[model samples]
Target: MKKTGLFFGTFNPIHIGHLIIANHMAEFSDLDHVWFVVTPKSPFKAKQTLLGDHHRYQMVLEATQEYPKLEPCDIEFKLPQPNYTIDTLTHLQERYGDSRQFALIMGEDNLNGFHKWKNYEAILEYYQLYVYPRISGQKIAEALKDHPKIHRVAAPVMEISSTFIRREHKAGKNIRPLLPESVWRYMDEMNFYR
Candidate 1:
């Protein structure tokens, strides 16, 4: 089975930080490919500058075009709103079958609250989780901190966030450096966050 990493996010605007993490997983980790699963909606977040689903997916496609191991996935777009990880994983298994082994790529901060996710226990029981370091004040959950299925990857700590970029651009600040050149130019041409 080919090992794959599923990096889920709304990707309101895919940035360089997102690219670094995904590419690192594809090249440095056990994953053969890293798929950026563009989420339609996040149950945890309020949609502030949430662009259309297709637009965000398009941005991901443009940003990842150069990377052969990185792919943009819109799996959750066809699923119901308020999509959950467990459900998506189940769906992916059904669609891709046993030929692919899928894992979740997450930030260290999210590990702190992983237990709160719906069917999180089932998720851990069934799939591996590739955790990347993040600059967070929270501690990882005791149960998850030492789970056998969790693999902590020593990827770069990316402090950049889409929210910050959007806020700065809206304030007339140049936030182009924080994004991939293709993504930055696309956002600029679209007049997004302005």
Candidate 2:
């Protein structure tokens, strides 16, 4: 069976940090492929500040072009809005469970609030979670230290954030260093986040 890691995010603009983590998970973890699941709107995030779903999806596609194992998925686009991770996973299992084993890839910060997620316990029961380190995650890391389903990955922790990029771009600063060249050019051409 193909072991796939589902890295779900709004990816307002796909950045090098996102690529690095996804690539690291694909290489270092037991995952055979890492799918960048672009959600149209996340229940936990404000939708007004997000780039259009299609735009974010395209940016992910462009940014991940060089990585064979990294795929940009639009499955959530066809599903309901204010998407919940569990629903997406359930759909994926129904569609690909026969040939693929899906794992959830998330930041340790998300794990901090994992209990508040919709059907959180069901998620733990059904899928393995690969958590990467994040700044200010130590407290939650300690809290979840005994959770057998969550695996802490030794991926490099970069402080890069899409919110920071958006803020800098809106402030008329160059954000090239923080993003993939193609995604940066596309955002520039479209005058996004300005």
Candidate 3:
């Protein structure tokens, strides 16, 4: 069975940082493949700043076309909203069955606040967590530092963010280098963030 890592993000416009991180997970970690799970907007939230769900998914699809071990997943679109990680993980495992073992891909920054997530303990009990480095001031939880289920991956610390790219593009600056060529072309053609 192949180990599949689930990288969850809105990916308003999937960028090179996301691509590099996902690639690193697939190649450097125990995970054989990494799926960019494009998280949909929550219905309860009043803000609609995010791009359409399909638009973000398309960006992820275009960004990952060159990578054999990476792909885009829109499973959450059909699932009930206000979804939790545990729910998503359970659904993924059930959907794929025994053919693929699923794990969560996260950054060190998220580790500090992980205990607060819904059913955090259940998630740890059922699945492994592959955490990549991030430039953050907060420290990871003391008890989780040596947890057997959490694997720290030596991936690059990517400072780039989709928010930064959006701001720069809206300012008429060239942020093309931060994104994959296909993603950039698609965003440009759609007049996104401008």
Name the top lDDT candidate: 1
| Clash tally, candidates in order | 0, 0, 0
Score each candidate by Cα lDDT. 0.93, 0.92, 0.90
Stretches of candidate 2 off by over 4 Å are: 141-143
> For residues 1-194, could you state the per-residue lDDT of candidate 1 as single tens digits?
89999999999899999999999999998899999999988989886659998889999999999999999999999998899999999999998876999999999999988888999989999999999999988987788878999999999999999999888899999898888899988898999888
Model 2, residue 13: displacement in angstroms? 0.8
Regions more than 4 Å wrong, model 1: none
List of clashing residue pairs for candidate 3:
none
For each candidate, C-alpha RMSD in Å?
0.8, 1.2, 1.5
* lDDT per residue (tens digit) for residues 54-105 in model 3: 8999999999989999999999988888767788888998989679999999
Question: Model 3 off-target regions past 4 Å?
Answer: 42-47
Which prediction has more favorable lDDT, 1 or 3? 1
**What TM-score, to 2 decimals, does candidate 2 have?**
0.96
lDDT of 2 by residue, 46-105 (tens): 889988888999999999999999999999999977788888999999999999999999
* Residue 168 error, candidate 3, Å: 1.1
